[model samples]
Target: MLRRMFAPEGPTFRELAVQALSSVEHGYDLLAPKFDHTPFRTPESVLAPVSRALRELGPFGSGLDLCCGTGAGMDVLRQVCRERVTGVDISAGMLAVGRARETVPARAPRMEWVRADARALPFGPVFDLVVSFGAFGHFLPGERPGLFAQVRSVLRPGGRFAFPIAAPSRPGSAAYWMLAGFDAVMRVRNALWHPPFVMYYRPFRLSDVRAELARAGFAVRLHALPELGRRPDGSPRCRLVVATRAEAV
Candidate 1:
């Protein structure tokens, strides 16, 4: 089932190569048609558990899907948030495709699709929750502070910003080598290319990320999504970072 979804009508090798060579925003625009069919789209397995956790945490009012590609995360927000849901991304093509998604029911939260960079979100303190999935890799480590601050700024005080972070694959493992090689190739590509298409696999560390979030004025906590199961070391394979904006003193 997983193999079939990612295999059918998804981007071809040549198409993926073209996208890799293109600028980040333009690459997504090119891939928007078949994005949902690609493994790049966050799967239902992860979404289901994330939504369940958010449900237990919430009844949140307004929600934002930061960098929502084809609105997969928006569906989760619809189920958990009551007032309104917004999906914002830099790619207009992605937003257009997401607008046509049938995942959200008419009775669900009212929805908005906005085209904007995540680093420079065009919203004030209006959202009670902001969630992002699988989109952080595009930003360099230096960019995380400003990006987190932007999410913090858009969220109302006491609101939450949530996303999943998977446990690192053990060193010398196949997954580790694959990710390391990918990042190495990307580094070479960016050094030679004009506008870098900056998707990286290994740069986001939980400790560094927590520090950045704290610097952005968020009180951070990690909720283990046990449905994803645990690592051999007994730690969770994936944990949701639930960072809340501090209430006024």
Candidate 2:
């Protein structure tokens, strides 16, 4: 599975190393063309279940995809939203690729792409639903509060901000150790490099995220994505965090 995912068709190790060395925006700019082929891209197994879950919550009107990398979350918006779907990201290269790949049926909602920082979004309280996929690792832990607030600011009263999160790997397990090592490397790289790549496999805890969402004036909820299946302990392997903007906010 690992070999097939990082196959020859994807960006080579040298190319990935170059990307990691550059500033986040420039790195994605260099990587934009081949990103979908990489293991970093959100897989269909996750997307499919997310789409189904969002469809159940909707009939939503304008939907926004926050930090939408190459617009993977647009697929979910298109399925659930009624009027329009927009993808906003910090990387121009990523937005361009998403724009180029977009195909909408006549009946489908209109689509738009914007380039902007997630921390300071250039939008009002206009979106009815918002979703992001596999892009949180780009943010530092300190940015969570402001990031959640920014998400709330762009959502209409009673609007929703949704994303998928998986269960953390068990401690001492290979996956857990691998992620720990990856985070350690990232920390070292950020300490030594001029422009940090800002990708870490861990540290976005569910409890902290939910608390921050509440602090940002969102009423949070969780929905199990059964299609993703469960762990050996019978707990859900993945879940969708749906943070609705409080009606007063």
lDDT of 1 by residue, 104-214 (tens): 566788999999999899999999999999999999999999999899899998999999999998999998998999899999999998688999969899999999998
Question: In lDDT terms, how accurate is model 2?
Answer: 0.90
Clashes of each: 0, 0
- Residue clash pairs of candidate 2: none
- Alpha-carbon deviation at 38 in model 1, angstroms: 0.6
TM-score of each predicted structure versus truth = 0.96, 0.97
Best-fitting candidate, measured by lDDT?
1
Q: lDDT tens digits, residues 1-249, model 2?
A: 567546877777788889989999999998899888887778899999999898888889999998888988998899999899999999999999999999988899999999999999999999999999988999988998899899999999889999999999999999899999999999999999987789875989998888888988999999999999999999999999999999764
Best by TM-score: 2
Q: Residue 127 deviation, candidate 2, in Å? A: 0.4
